[model samples]
Target: MSGYFVTKGSKFKGRPLTTLPVVLNQDLSRIINSNLQLKSSHDLEHLRSVAQQTDEWTKLTVRIREAAEASQSEH
Candidate 1:
């Protein structure tokens, strides 16, 4: 292993955000995205203005067999 790296805003709350891929076909994905935006009031207004919203969409996958927090550099 090399070294550990944590983002500026990340705090050691004894846990981290993670996910198990929730695959959705285009139809299902669109439903989820629309509902999220509607509920958030399309709160991500900057994203709405863009022509293509591919970046706004999360591809939904992360694969890491193991990771260790060797150390943390605090902000």
Candidate 2:
């Protein structure tokens, strides 16, 4: 728990635990690589564009709430 903040030139119990080994070999590697390959969504809606639109709407909503609060306070 407390012994997990990574730093350079660090060793653990002896064998340099700073770098973790990723075992991507043989059939496992081929299957993983095939599955991990990027493919576009079926509906033609990209995640990045949807995310940007959601962010813009959230910001506008926050601004509208703040303006309403300010008007109430002034009255």
Candidate 3:
């Protein structure tokens, strides 16, 4: 699924922060986007480990992580 990240603060907040759109497999997308709360960072890490089992998903996750770091630096 494709998604955009919206800035939370004021001053052009509604604009998308990252230029690239995220594309995830249906199962992965469902798990990540689900309402269920991850209990802790370890849970998230475990999820990432599972997703990284596929080479395509591993690359996508790296790109997503880099984009997120870049966006954070901009603020």
Candidate 4:
């Protein structure tokens, strides 16, 4: 239920690019201590590399909720 997401490279429309979706999971420090080398092959890749300490992740969660509400209102 809790994991990270890595997206793939973009698609082409004419001369522009589009977004793609891909997911990958690396070994967490709680799981492994070795350094990881990831290849660049995506237009967008999101990672939850660091563990949230206190209210750090909370701010992001709140911002996301606010954005969602704003989007809903725009519709």
Candidate 5:
């Protein structure tokens, strides 16, 4: 009935546009904290490490993509 809804009979419903960014950011923070063991999102050393280590960068990118895909599929 509302603008957020796809249709009365639709199986998938629309979510607030702002939700994706919030979810993605939370996912990013979780990955950085738990996987990368970084204290701050702005850690320069982590950035340097990612830049220097191809494997680390690849892993990070894969995790981010997975998280984004999962979030999108949910909506």
Candidate 6:
């Protein structure tokens, strides 16, 4: 069995192994391309707005902590 890397730069067997030719999902290429596409100003502004909003940040932190606790409990 072989493990896949979330990143392309991952190496294996002391070689620069990146993508696996077989068992490759076609959607994986699309996903990479979509991620590579530059984000628009609207997206940046939205992220900035979320960061600027203290209430939102606090809510997000609380939610993240809740998720962490839930995952730990599931283990």
Q: Give the alpha-carbon lDDT of every model.
A: 0.29, 0.37, 0.47, 0.35, 0.57, 0.44
Model 2 over residues 43-63: C-alpha lDDT tens digits? 123323433798854654465
The prediction achieving the highest TM-score against the true structure is 5
> Mind giving the per-residue lDDT tens digits that candidate 6 earns over 3-37?
33234483556754444322122222233222211
**Per-residue alpha-carbon lDDT of model 4 for 1-75, expressed as tens digits?**
122123436653685322222212221111233232223422113223322434644654454456556667989
Task: In model 2, state the lDDT of residue 37.
Answer: 15
Off by over 4 Å in 6: 1-45
The residue pairs found clashing in candidate 6 are none
- lDDT string, candidate 1, 1-75, tens digits: 011222357465865534221222222233432432212223334334432555444432110111111112221
Cα lDDT of model 3 by residue, 1-75, tens digit: 111233446665575444322233222333433432233455455556667779856765665566566667989
Q: Write down the TM-score of every candidate.
A: 0.15, 0.31, 0.32, 0.36, 0.47, 0.40
Better of 3 and 4 by lDDT: 3
Q: Which 10-residue window in model 2 sums to the lowest lDDT?
A: 19-28
- Count of clashes, each model: 0, 0, 0, 2, 0, 0
lDDT of 5 by residue, 4-75 (tens): 222447464576445543444466664534554333444435655685989977887788787678778989
Could you give the candidate ranking by TM-score, starting with the highest?
A: 5, 6, 4, 3, 2, 1
TM-score of 4: 0.36
